[model samples]
Each structure stands twice: as structure tokens, then as C-alpha cells.
Target: GMAEEEARMMRIDPEKLTQIILMGYTTKEARRGLRSAQGNIDQAVEFIIENRRLREECHREEEAREEEERIQRRYGLTENGQKINITYLQQLQSMGYPRRACVEALKQSNNRLEEASEMLLTNLDTLITASRVAKRDNEDDDDQETELMEDATHIPQLIALGAEFEEARALLEIYGNRLERAVEELLQKAQDSYETMHEHNDPSLFERARTAVEKRMAKKIRLAEQSAADQQRRT
Candidate 1:
């Protein structure tokens, strides 16, 4: 019910998603950000709750997207738009080339089995190198994906401390391995975001939160300076 309703609300403009990705947001973040920016918020509290749910759903949606991409890369669909011929791929693979290289050759040859087989035989080295580069990129992404799992360990703690799951994970990722820092930042965001979302309806409270954030940052700077000075003296 909610899935259909949300789909109706935001179909996710592919052009917007591409532009957002080019602007340096990850594909997942771009999708989530689009959902957030396009949501029609009736109330601040409701928006906060809804945003959390949307973010959680964004994770699942992104997973599905990743699966689709893998399928396209390996198997290729039957229709147009970069679809590889599975038969061509299989035949080429039977010739002892990698599935990755075979898929690339098939796509490069427009799914003509003879041409694809010829390319695989003639340009095997280049095809293998290109696939290696792509595999390397995917490996790098796998490392970053592992980092997301590492960040997840702190979610229960944050939730127990009364912060939302998705918000806590986002803050922890932004802060990177600093549980205390992420918690403080999450609290600040919760306060500031509600005020900002509500059209500054409570400017006084927002101002106080800003003041506290400034003080915290100053304290961190002072601590860093002291540590650096101590190191300099030791040196």
C-alpha cells in the first residue's frame, strides 16, 4: 500500500538522478535525497518520521538497483539499451573467455555471435584488461560497502539512546567511527532540522542549538591545538 502510494508521489526522475550522481552524491544517496526533497510535508514531526521511513526504504531500493545492475552487466536483458545476448555470451564463454569479457564483446559486437567470437579471439588481452579494471572498481566499492556494515554496529546503541536508526547511521557515516561525535551531531541535527523544517517557527530554540554547536566545535579545536602543541614540545 505504502509502496504504491510513495511510487505515485515520486517516480524518481532519471535525469535528476543522473545529475545528482554527477554532483557527487552516491546513487543511493541521490535516490534518497530526491525522495526527501520531493516529499510534501504537512508537519515537522510527521516529516521527520516519514523521512526516516523513506531512508530505510531507500536502502532496500538501492539494493534492488544493485542487483539489477549486476544482472545487466553479466546476463544482459533481451530488449535494447546495453542488453547483451546471453546466447552470444554463453558461446563466447565456451571459448574459454571470462563471462565479463564475453559480455563486453557481445555488447561491442551488437550481439552477433560470429563478430563477438572474433573479437574475443583477437582482442582477448584488451577485453581481459578492461574487465580487470571494472572488477577493480567493483572491489573498491566492495570495500566501501564493507564500511557501511562496520558503521551498522553502532546503530543499536544510537537507537537505545533515543535517536532514529537511519539518522544515526547517516550521522555515524558522516563522522566516521566516532560514536560520541556522531551521537552529539545526531542530537544537533535533530534539533536544527526540526526548526529548519518547521520554517524557523521556534527561532529561540534553534539559536540555542546553534550556540551549543559552536561551543562544542570550539572546545574540539582547543583540544586539537593543545595536543598538537604537546607533540611539538616533545619533538
Candidate 2:
């Protein structure tokens, strides 16, 4: 009714006004656009269409961000959904696995703690028997095993260079265990990331990134505390 009233006042047809509203124009916005276009329905609709496109784009971006945050919380992923939980590492440690071994398993299993743990428990000595018995084998299995070993070996080296355990392993696996290449690639990525942030200079983006990292860190801290308590109880 308000749209109709505004349309009547502006000498625009009721049908045109309804069309404008359906195109995501508010009554006031429709009136303004129509008035600026000298009451041309086509011109007003063009304006509404462009404005609606921009609004939809922004809405989609916000929805995507919310979904990502939700997934991070649900799956215990790190800030950018690229890392596993520290809690998983702590849990495996509480189960008597070494930190290095736990890290290796997690890398091999794509961060699935249970799968990694199982892999750690299974004996690789059976590999000789399996190789003798098997008629056909996956060509990539050996390559994958080699890659995992490279990740395991280079993780410590990467940590020595100031990268965290998971971060180091991820970079090495990504760069195919060429240590210098991985380091150079990571350095370049960091530089590019910094330059992008500098160019945008968005405080809100920074805040959101900080909040996500803090959320992951806080969860890890809680896991550490819980693990300590459990160990004390056991002792």
C-alpha cells in the first residue's frame, strides 16, 4: 500500500511500482529512482537491478563467512580450515604416542585422529607378507608412504626454522619435501599475505582473523588443561 501510495504520488503505474519492489527496491528507493529517471520504469528497474546485485553479492559473502566459522567450530579446524586441532595431538599423547609419531599419523590421515591412531598401532612389518601375497598393488601407495616420511622427517627441520609442527609438515607435504623450496614458498606466501593485508588495511578483516585464531588457541589450551587433569588422576 505504501508503495502504491508512493507510486500514485509519483504518477508511476501500480504495476511498475510492484515490479520495482519485487526487484528488491524499497518504496522510497523506487520512488527516487523513478523520479530521477523522469518516471521511466525501465531506467528505475535498471537501477534496482544493479543495486540488488550488489546487495546479493554482499549477502552471499557474509553467509559464506558464517558457514566457515561454523565448520571450524564443529570440526575443530584451525582459523582458515587448513589445520587440525591441537586437542587431537594431546589426546594421542595421553594414549602413549610420541608427539612426533602423532604428528606423522595425523598428517597421513588428513587430520583424522582415530584413523591416525589406528595407523600408528598397525605394524608395518606385515608389509613384507602383504607384498608377497598381493597380486596387484596401488602404484601410489609407495609414493604416499614416501611423502608421509618426508613430511615426518622435515617437520622437525621446519619447526627449527620457527614454523609450528603442523605448519611445517603441511608446507613440506605441499612442496613435495624439497626443504628449500618449501621454505621459499612459505616465505613468499607470507609476504604476499602481508602485502594483501597492507593494501586492504581492513580492521574488521584483521579482527575476524584474530578472533578465529584465538578460538582455536583457546580450545587447545582447554585440551591441555583437561589432559593434565586426567594424567594427575591416573597418577
Once model 1 is optimally superposed onto the true structure by TM-score, how far is the C-alpha of residue 95 displaced, in angstroms? Answer: 2.0
lDDT of each candidate versus the true structure: 0.66, 0.63
Distance (Å) between predicted and true CA of 18, model 2? Answer: 7.4
The sequence of per-residue lDDT tens digits that candidate 1 reaches over residues 117-165 is 7876677667667655766666433322222444544655676666765
TM-score of each: 0.27, 0.27
Off by over 4 Å in 2: 1-26, 35-38, 77-235
Model 2, 7-106: lDDT tens digits are 6656866777787778777997787678767678898877767777998999999997775554334333332345554667668645543444554456
- Window of ten residues with lowest summed lDDT in model 2: 138-147
lDDT of 2 at 122: 72
Clashing pairs in 2: none
Candidate 2 differs from the real structure by a C-alpha RMSD in angstroms, to one decimal, of 23.7
